[model samples]
Target: MSEAHEARISRNEEDIQDIWKVVEDIKKVLAARPPLWCTFLLMALSSGLTGFIVRAFS
Candidate 1:
């Protein structure tokens, strides 16, 4: 293969590796956070309360 083509391929590989590293770092950060169930539970409770209030007032 031509030298320029080989160089481009090498750079592309490095770029791909860099992207994977960023993705792995992001995965680690997200894994360290608490689960989302609490948020969902709060949302559900709020919606239920709002619905109850609306119904009672109507």
Candidate 2:
């Protein structure tokens, strides 16, 4: 492949790695902060929506 293609692929890989690191940092922050009732409420809502979508399509 060309140098330009290789450079772009390298940049894409670096960007993905940076994003994953940010996600891990956010998880650590959340774990330390430990949101109270609101987090549980949101989690329940997310699970309910997921179940609803699965049942609807299935």
Candidate 3:
């Protein structure tokens, strides 16, 4: 291949790698949220139950 062609391929490869890293970082952030939501949901349910019990006891 010509030198220009090789240079273009290398640049394209670097761009792809950079994009892949960004995608991976985004994936990591996305993957880390479900458990947090589950915890929040559990806390909300517990608080609601406590409120219900208090009202019932009153």
Q: Which residue runs of candidate 2 sit more than 4 Å off their true CA positions?
A: 36-58
Cα lDDT tens digits for candidate 3, 1-58: 9999999999999999999999998778768897887788799999999999999999
Cα lDDT tens digits for candidate 1, 1-58: 9999999999999999999999999788667763675576689999999999999999
lDDT of 2 by residue, 1-58 (tens): 9999999999999999999999999788777777765688799999999999999999
- For all predicted structures, in order, the TM-scores are 0.59, 0.60, 0.57
Candidate 1 lDDT score at position 38: 58
Evaluate model 1: give its lDDT. Answer: 0.89
The candidate that achieves the highest lDDT relative to the unseen native structure: 3
Model 3 local distance difference test score:
0.92
TM-score of 2: 0.60
Q: How many clashes in each candidate?
A: 0, 0, 0
